[model samples]
Target: MLRRYQTAICDALASVDGGSFCEDMWTRGRSGGGGCSRVLQDSTVLEKGGVNVSAVHGTLPPDAVTKMTCHGHHDLPAADGEGLQFYAAGLSMVIHPRNPMAPTVHLNYRFFQIFRRAPSERSGTNECGGEEATEGESLLWWFGGGADLSPSYVFEEDCVFFHEKLREQCDRCDPLYYARFKRWCDAYFRNHHRNEGRGIGGIFFDDLNENMTVSPEKFFAFAEDGLQTFIDA
Candidate 1:
């Protein structure tokens, strides 16, 4: 999915200009993992931008694990303990268009896996009745992400159009999603020091998973919907 989005976003942005996105593949520190970063700059449309995908694995620092709220994983080991294994992959992109009238936008969707050292099957299923199975010492995991529109030149109609499109997508995933996430976005993008918002409102959510009454697959589709929205908007 991340790979697909990497290409789709770059292709969409590239259409705005004849130039193609430069691809940079990078390896993580400690040889944990690697990902590709596709970027475009100084184009007729985009001033600068990047669509990046990364999947990395490492032991989180003690303090960092304590700060992770996804699936309430605080009790899990952070470092040299029973298991400190962690894996995270995400598709994140930020677009800065040359035209200030065209808003800068951001969309990010990520998945996390926190578990003990375990080698599980691809299905993650148990032999007993073929029930759902988790690898050794599985601790917690979930989905988190959102999209926002940041405009240097605010357009009321554009804001309404963007919000309405996102709302339509969210409603498909869950009828109650829009209002809840809309409020969440408003608070998240606020600039309390300046008493204003950094961008027009969009949806923001975190800690989404089956336990949270949302499936990972559904949310992933929602992420794709958002990517397309930016491509078209």
Candidate 2:
């Protein structure tokens, strides 16, 4: 399971630069499995933040699939008399600052599964995808991860720098990708009920597969590198 690998990731990250930062842990029960959430804060740099890791598994009920409707992409398994088996593990984080000028950051990286690939699943055929590609293979065996920034105050330079770093990673695979996903990032982060975004946007991307230029290993490397940039920024 990815749970063991994810725990190793957290340990490696924390043992390195994150050790000095303040830490916290959080957990909750789920119909299937629970989650572990962690946080590291620096009084001078961040007001409060969390690095959460969750290991959860179970059949995704219909209500669960409906919740993702907002994403405009849903390809869950057929409702057989039996339930689907699924497992997921990953890290997510959010930083809210006392000083609004510095900007707030959010990040999430997750992996998921389904019993197996269903031939009838939609292929994510939208022409607007950040990376141009084909479909047929399952999106279920995949990883989704991205980091974004929202500043109460706009800092064009900071925004540009942030986007550029992410762009550098995406550009290595596809030049058009970074720009495409940047727009996606801006559109996805709104608090629709409130009719406002969390902050002036940074960048966000998800559902990346090994088929993408950034292979699983490379994706993690880029993600880790991006986290360092976020800290330094």
**Per-model C-alpha lDDT, please?**
0.74, 0.57
TM-score, structure 1 vs. true: 0.83
Q: Which parts of model 1 have CA positions greater than 4 angstroms off?
A: 69-83, 118-135, 210-215
Task: Give the best candidate by TM-score.
Answer: 1
Tens digit of lDDT per residue, candidate 1, span 1-233?
A: 67876787788778777778888877665345677888899888898998988876666565666666444654566555433567678889898998888899888888787776643433432211122323456576777888988998898998899999888878888889999888998999899999997789798888777673555678778777766666666
How many Å off is the CA of 7 in candidate 1?
Answer: 0.7
RMSD of 1: 5.9
Worst 10 residues of 2 by lDDT: 125-134
lDDT of 2 at 103: 76
Model 1, global lDDT: 0.74
TM-score for each of the candidates: 0.83, 0.63
Q: Residue pairs in steric clash, candidate 1?
A: none
Model 1 / residue 214 / CA error / Å? 5.6
